[model samples]
Target: MRNYVGAIAAVCLAACGEPGGTDVSSAPGALELTREADGAASGAWGQGEARVRFASRRVESGVYRIEVRQNGMSLTGLVDAEQGVSSLDGFAEDNGQDTQMLDGDRELLAGLYAALGAELPAGSALAPELKYLRRAVGLWAEHPPAVELQRTVMGEQGRGYTMLCGYAKCNGKFTGSCGTTFNWYSYAKHDCQHGGFDLAANQQIAQLGDHATCDGDELYMSGGKWVCGEPDHQSRPKVQGNCFGRCGPGCGGDTQYTVDATNHDGCVRNGHALTSAYCNDQFTAASDDELYAPDCY
Candidate 1:
């Protein structure tokens, strides 16, 4: 499912360079996040196929331990009650985009594409769109939601993917990569935390260690503050970068926190009883708010 605040970013590499060897093993109900690669693929170092997977087990009510394993890399971390403070903390800068990992979480999902063994569109095909969109927003120069949490790249092909829509199609339109739908004001104002996004460009730049100038969106910041507008690829004939970012000084962490907490508390209270009633309807499943349910099993 698409992560809310701690969705994915700043993946914390364990000291032992492997998952179980890290703190995740100590969690009360430490469930393995990613499944072990099939033994058939074991000892096969040059497979060249990139697939990413992760999983988490609740340690207690409102608490979880998460881990991501892909290629030969692994990262482990925990999600505390308030969704702030994670061990995978880090700051990443690319192109003109600047993003943070975990406030406790901002882009744990980006680690997916970073390590994905999928068939990626050529960088050439990826550049023009990025170049165009960057120009559209006057090259806003701030990349929000550094990680693209749209699909889990399972293999080196298009069919080798799945959607992380924790709820249903969020906002009735934009698929939460932050915003790709032309007029995403509703989504930006309501559902950008789902950790999914729609990229107009057929090609995407794996911004982790392979990021080029062709990543991020122009609309991410306009005269300061998160906004949604102009040249939406899903609407207009241009590409738009509808990415979100982590908590920080000018990033509006305080306001976003207030908005998030209010919605989360509402869900923690009675969202299950009232479906589609609140804008945060998906929080129960997406954010694992169901853990707060009387019978959370």
Candidate 2:
């Protein structure tokens, strides 16, 4: 029930992105709960980073660890914003606002620990609310559709490996007690409602849009927004033209060509931005905005 992918929604949340943009955060994964807590490791994420990684290793058989190294180093953080502002920002996900959330959690954690072979410390964060989670996990496990979240899927790694995927109703807000009611009717309906998860089997992964994978982009989600060190972007279907000038090896400086513009790709070389106006000339058919940060897709 964590909105880890919620970061990308802020810029175009109500505005509607590109009219036909690829639905980025809609994918469902088991590592969602884990990533949400890791990226936004405050408030509801009482589990902490250490535990999340340990539990994660149990799921994909250390495949996640391998992917991190394959990717870049800057992608360490996934989602995070500020005080009291969780990934489900502008909605709800703190323990303070809801108590029922804390109720059955004990059992929920138990089931998770049992499945992952992780041992819950005698004293752990959110331990008080666990008993609350336990009951809910049981009901969801016992019930048919509810039991679906208790679901597990074979990982992309193949070899018949599986990952645990789970879900519950969370409206980013609680009417009174945690389980008492939901703020958004959609979440209460239990049809994804922006809470379904899609665990990345790798160490870290994200996307800027349908155009580019966040692999080497150092992209992350924070306070319902995507955060990246550089504004580098690639077009969808992977633009297959000559990657020239700043987009390739110049940022407009003494050593590099880093031009500060929406259409300029934030390509960096020699520790400076790599950009040049010549790129705009190459893709004459494209709008200036579309060329922003045009790099080798």
Candidate 3:
């Protein structure tokens, strides 16, 4: 999905001294990327082909965690337009192998950045990274990378009720990687004290808004504070980033109430319920005089 924020700058990396690595920029050809109407992008840089896909979640009103999946690597690029600062948490291969690109994997980092930068939409949020990555490579002059992005209109946000969403471990194990869509939200109430789930991981948050509805089978609420629901796991979008950071300031220690997808009775309580209708009630009741009530169907 297109990121929620706009114009957050990119990170700077030192020159690459790593001798042996996949050198995408060093290949011979112009770098070109075309964003499809569906928002996914693909292109070729030198000898290899690269593709870009995105999943995003709002960190706050203006901050976003935009995961850029290029080829087989997932990059965590934090874009805080409100703050005007951006950072990449790091890169992880599809196999869950972490690569410390900042720690000396310069060649591969620059190559990945080049592909990612080139594949973004003409005015997309990652555009600034292209400039910074060029400077970081130091060899930009020798093999000056040219970025070509097709003029694709980014997607627009939907007009629906916004709700807080997150996922954590279940029964001492995470259902999926933080990046996996199927494992995005925990359908069970897995908390730090009761399940020994890491507090930092549980705090990584996302939102179900823009007219999206939760799965009817896994509906829940936290005493009218916020309602919990499940999105389609297979097709729900994915975001790249470590689940270590909390969603927003002061969201820590908030009690989470989730209906166990496997067994609903284990976590449902007085205020929480399993049906979508009850979820809507909790949502409507939580609003201020229903001023911003979600038009639940």
Q: Pick the candidate with the highest TM-score.
A: 1
Where does model 1 exceed 4 Å of error? 1-48, 82-84, 90-297
RMSD of 2: 25.1
Model 2 lDDT tens row, 1-297: 001233222221122112112122322212222223332111111232211111111112111110010001100111111111111111012221211212233323334333321222212333212221221222221121111111111111112111111111121112235443311111101101122222111111211111222444433334555554332222111110111111111111101111221122211211122222222222121111111111211
Compared with the true structure, what per-residue lDDT tens digits does model 1 show for residues 1-297? 112333334343333233333333322222222223321111111112433334444444444455444433333444443432323222221222223323222222332222221212112232222211111111011112333222111111122111212211232234456243233121222232322333221111110111012234233233444344332222212112312211111111011111222222222222122122332332312222111111100
Task: Put the candidates in lDDT order, highest first.
Answer: 3, 1, 2
TM-score of 2: 0.14
TM-score for each prediction?
0.25, 0.14, 0.24
Write the residue-wise lDDT of candidate 3 on 1-297 in tens digits.
Answer: 001233543422222122112233434445544433433333334423433333344445554444444445444544453443444433355445544323223344345444443444222443222322322221111111121110111111122222223333331123335332334442222232223323332222232211222343323233433344432222112221221111110111111222211112111221233222322222212211111111121
Q: Is candidate 1 or candidate 2 better by lDDT?
A: 1
Model 2 residue 243 distance off true place after TM-score fit, in angstroms: 59
Best-to-worst ranking by TM-score:
1, 3, 2
Looking at candidate 3, the ten consecutive residues that score lowest on lDDT are 144-153
